[model samples]
Target: MIAIFGSGETSPAMTSVHQELIARVSDPQLNAVLLDTPFGFQENADEIATRTIAYFREHVGCEIRLASYRHGGRATALEFEQFLSRLGNANYVFAGPGSPTYALRHWHDGAVRERLRAKLRQGGCVAFASAAAIGLGAYALPVYEIYKVGADPSWTEGLDLLGEVGVRCAVIPHYDNREGGTHDTRFCYMGEPRLRLLESMLPEDVLILGVDEYTACIIDFEAQSVTVRGRGGVTVRRRGTDRRWQRTTFALSELSHPQVAPAAVPDSASGRPEPDGTDGSPMVEQAREWGAHGRDALDRRDVDGVVAAILETENVLNAWAADLVGTDERDRVRAEMRNLVVRLGDLVRGGGREGVREYVAPLIDVLLSLRGEARREQRFKDADRLRAILAQCGVEVQDTPSGTAWSLQSQN
Candidate 1:
């Protein structure tokens, strides 16, 4: 059940979109659950939830569960798990908008992850708004860091239940209005530097799906089309081999049936697993082979080849994620997989620019080593310096009486 929606930054449009989706489902009598992943003090969260419930009750004759996490505090893994379990029984689930990083940090591991996966496996339809939509990819670029947080934008790991897929896309929520004036223009959301940075991070083959505000790229799996349901068209960008971006625009209907063929198998001995069942013939086998090839290319640091392999593997995985897990778990896994990609990116790019911006495991090793060898004054100075360096690398250091610990800063 592939679906997408956008309502700009307004609550009314969002509420309407929710109602429309619930009404569109085949079974109006089935229960539709609303999972609110709102940021702190979200004024519209309750309204959106209430309207969604009303729509479900009045139109669909169903109940709605307005699930919300604690504000300014991380939602426990157990809470997420319960939410996913509820989703498994839901006819539809809608994710509220907020900080993608915050929502992810809360739901990455444990029962929530598993439950989401289960929902997707069961082919449950799901909808995501704003941050949740951005987070619904193999990787999510935290654009809020540049736009709202006034910090260097960086990518974080997302749930990987989506497997090895990367949209490498940038979504601009309100593409129509210059409501924030020139100072806060749409260009601010798609700054030149950020576009360049995103280009540098992605392979040439990765496609950028840019959605305008108030518009949505509604993907229909059964129909194999991506119809634009709102007011804007989808923008596609293909960075050339010469490191140049080539931009083009396609009406929503044009992308509704973009041609994408099944993957082909590589002519190698150590290929991917072959299909055993009669139903799983050429296409499935080819995808498995491509996945193996992609994994090998990744190990060899063949960026272009790895990207190709990932794309092919993703095509196969999308079906797997959609059919086996449903949309919610697929979305969750996509987030986790993206987090892995960020880690992979760090490895590919020879570690991050910030010296202390290594992976958690390596950073912990370095900190432990430094802490072990320091004299009294040296210890203080080294710890302070390390903390400062970590901060510059987007890490927050907390020195408790027992020991020092760290966490990634809020990506806004």
Candidate 2:
């Protein structure tokens, strides 16, 4: 089985995907490993590895060891063999985020590509995202070479891992990125113009398998089918035309033959009712959903999630405002937006982001208790050290007659 994530491999969005992958393993303890070669060249490779490991252990509730094969040429013979042995032996392997060209070159130099294919053949699960995902197709897009270095769009040899399941195509992650703002940044930053040229460069039979951000295209070879899940879905590009399949499952063989593929069905026709069944506008329902997300995030004290929900709700309102239609749905959505804004205001009062305080209060209280112990023992330096650490984090501590109080410093 293979899981290709367009983005957010280790983020809150993909937590369920990781959980699904690890849960499939029969072992009580997951025999999982992270292949770190993709982003191994970074100065903070160790930090990345640590954070990724922590995310799995804490967020995903699984244990994953690292197969630290940074660069093939620089690695010792023992290190190279250990990396392969670990990857081959593990039932689940994960790799994500880096330069596609660098990963291809590293895989080619280290001969790790064959081991990956062999593992897949043996029914092991290989979940890849971003750069690692781009390298699994019949050909890879040299993302940095073309998007960063001003080189012409061209194809580089890929590991052809998708070919193992009879999907003859190139994998393009970030298929729906809008980071270009006024400009187009879709198709992994190749944009439409360069992307069109690159599409013309492909072989006649090979199509393009474009995965949108925060989406997963899971290919189950044993089942001979493919499933799409997440915020967005798969975009199949064939012969200069594009087809979108969202939250749908299709036979894996249809990818190569392009026959019997299903088109997107409307919610009403597909037995799925509108969110409220009263409003015809999808944006109104979307705003309601994002507003709910904001409330949930506020409850959990997830600062980023709350902010994202608020911004998304605002975007929905802006989009609806541009429309000429007037309805009560819009007013209801406005109420939802106003409620979210009021919640946001409550979360950032008394000159600090109280959301952070709500999230960290228990830990802060524990630390202060430790400081109190140090003070009682006359270890003034240790107590001062604790206070200084909090100060560095913009947490002002005050010792009052009642108790200790702490507040985050205002950036403004």
Candidate 3:
């Protein structure tokens, strides 16, 4: 699926530009589906949804499905799964603008991500705006940098539905909109320094595609080209001993193949074949096999097997993490570890203590911050009571030099 981004949809010019692009690829008699996953500026969601529906109806004469998800916080609804199932048969899917962090926090591994991957692989076209555009790549940028979350503005592992296709390619949407909010409006979304910092974090071969508002980098896999449609040119950054920038008008034929070949996992890192084992799986492969078995066991009501499988997965992930330490690939491995935790949480929900703790860690950090602040300002009684309350909920608190930390002592 190819994604698009713009500054904002409040303007008629942006909407018209998007409409024309859709018209270019859409057919009147064919049914096309648009999925609007707008997590940022939700107040404008209804307007954007209405405009999108109207655009397709007036131009393409195709049916549009507005899968408007307001809050994708946790525990995805089965209704969303059904919504994605519907998209599997769609001709086109478009996600609306929003915060990439929020969207990824909510939808990364849920039913929506799976459906999107399925649609793209089936040769369907997908367009994403703003946050959704960021979601289209392999990493979700922490756009909300002022927030504590932004301090780390490190890339989180995205759906991986696109595999390594968009790795190191940071999609700076609204690149030319100086009127848009933020200091990095012109150079980078954050600023030149921060952009450079981000670049330094990425592999040397990664490219930055700074697309202007109302413009799109249309990637056609079939044609093996990336064409620029609308008002702006695409910026290509090749950084080595020195950084070189090139601004070129693109056509649908340019971006068919990656500028650099996708990185491959080392054979030693790749699982070794089992000796006397028919599956010919390596250690990592065996670990994944056990993880899948655990998921299946959970689905089939074999709670005991699920527990065993989850522990085995954890061990494998830990070993993988150890191997990746101090390497450039550490963050990626850590992200995968987090994913494993999430998957394990899904399987063991209401099953036991381990399951609950896995799900509670992130939430616990948020709560501890609140409690720590209260205590720091001499609200000792309130802080102590809050801590006690958390203890009642099966959490144990430990005071640290940095702040207060907590962990689940037992799962109910």
Best by TM-score: 2
The segments of candidate 2 whose C-alpha lies over 4 angstroms from its true place after superposition are: 27-29, 259-412
- In Å, residue 366's CA in model 1 sits off its true spot by 66
Q: Name the candidate, 2 or 3, with the larger TM-score value.
A: 2
Give all candidates' CA lDDT scores: 0.49, 0.77, 0.53
- Highest-lDDT candidate: 2
Q: What lDDT score goes with residue 104 in model 3?
A: 75
Q: Can you tell me which runs of candidate 1 are displaced by over 4 Å?
A: 8-20, 23-28, 40-48, 51-63, 71-80, 110-121, 160-172, 175-177, 240-412
Model 1 Cα lDDT, one tens digit per residue, 75-137: 566765566667667767666466777777666655655555554555555666566666655
Residue 289 of model 1 has an lDDT of 68
Q: What is the lDDT of candidate 1?
A: 0.49
**What is candidate 2's TM-score against the reference?**
0.68
Clash list (residue pairs), candidate 3: 40-98, 224-256, 225-252, 225-253, 225-254, 226-255, 227-251, 271-282, 272-282
As a whole number from 0 to 100, the lDDT of residue 8 in candidate 3 is 37
Model 2 scores a C-alpha lDDT of 0.77
Residue 194, candidate 1: alpha-carbon lDDT? 53
Error at 108, model 3, angstroms: 1.9
Each candidate's clash count = 26, 0, 9
Candidate 2: minimum summed lDDT over ten consecutive residues — where? 265-274
Rate residue 285 of model 1 by lDDT: 48
Per-residue lDDT of 68-163 in model 3, one digit per residue for the tens? 455655326775666666666665777655567777766755667767766566556777766667666555567665333558546665555434
